[model samples]
Target: MFSKIVIACALVALCQAGFLHYHEAPIHYSAPDHFTPSQSYEAPAIHDEPAHEDHYVDEYAYPKYGYSYSVEDPHTGDHKSQHEERDGDVVKGEYSFLQPDGSFRKVTYTADHHSGFNAVVHNSPPVIHNH
Candidate 1:
């Protein structure tokens, strides 16, 4: 009686496991007949106009505002760095580095007046910053 009961319990457990592991087939519905196929239409071809060699300027010419960076020495302990701007407003500024995991993590001085900073992390909503 004991052996029979043990075998029955084992069979029940195995059956439960199998049932839990089973996956149902995904049901996919076909598009309606009234739906028009997008590939049936063709885009108009663009014709190349004659190139104006005389109107061409040097491609390597420098612009008015140049991009540059100034790095401060860590001995001075100055956290204030150049501010990043968007549409003439300070979006982010006062950058500092935190070495939590051998990589430099950026710490920005965020203002309540702006939108927010954003950073992407796995399984979590991205970090947002506005100033």
Candidate 2:
């Protein structure tokens, strides 16, 4: 009786596997000769100005959530840009700059996701009057 039951189960399993294989589509294969390889070409040379002592400076205001952080170049009694980020969070920070017109501009960044976010304080420097 046990042998009969085992045979019956095996037959059912075999039927199911056969049905699945019968319904499955055949694999499609393409020969490598059908593909066209791209030709090798040299890229155009890009000219960029050489970096100097004051070429570029960046700063960041990291989050205080026990996450790893780094500040490239913080306020050094001079003008510079800043950026900061926390784990699984969009980068948030502020930038204060002195315009070429001898005025100051303050910009605050709040949760800058790829979509975008609110900018509470966005003020530009007022025109300076040279006496």
Candidate 3:
């Protein structure tokens, strides 16, 4: 029992000695944040592709059956013009328009029974502006 008491006292002394040797890390206070209000942004100018509409269809095989090309899309072709023409059973056209997210969507399509309706769409990422 006496040995147990001495052991307990020695353990406490050892703990205190270890505690005295330990040192706390230095503390530093950060500077307060300062932010400036953002400025209003202006819109960028849109450069839409011009129309290349043909007055009449030109075809060696069938001039009368030849189709003149042009399509005004309701969704994205507000001020944009598309190219389209019917070469007998086959039809082809291309058009481009701006997106709401400042991206560009261009589509080239062809339709026929042999190849079916095929559309090749090209998408461009939006450009960021700093104001």
On TM-score, the candidate that comes out on top is: 3
Per-residue lDDT tens digits for candidate 3, residues 12-37, read 88888843477799999999999988
Assess candidate 2 and give its TM-score to the true structure.
0.30
Q: TM-score, each model?
A: 0.19, 0.30, 0.41
lDDT of 1 at 107: 47
Q: How close is candidate 3 to the true structure, as a TM-score?
A: 0.41
lDDT (CA) per prediction: 0.51, 0.62, 0.77
For 1-131, candidate 2 gives per-residue lDDT tens digits of 99999999999888888433456778999877677878998899999978867555566655454323333344543554545444556656666665556566666666645657756565565676879
**Residue range 8-84, candidate 1, lDDT tens digits:** 99998888884347789999999877976677867899999988677666686432232224465577544223434
Best by lDDT: 3
CA RMSD per model (angstroms): 19.0, 24.6, 25.3
Q: Which should have the higher TM-score, number 2 or number 3?
A: 3
For candidate 1, give the lDDT of residue 101.
Answer: 34
Better of 1 and 2 by lDDT: 2
Off by more than 4 A, model 3? 1-79
Report lDDT (Cα) of residue 126, candidate 1: 36
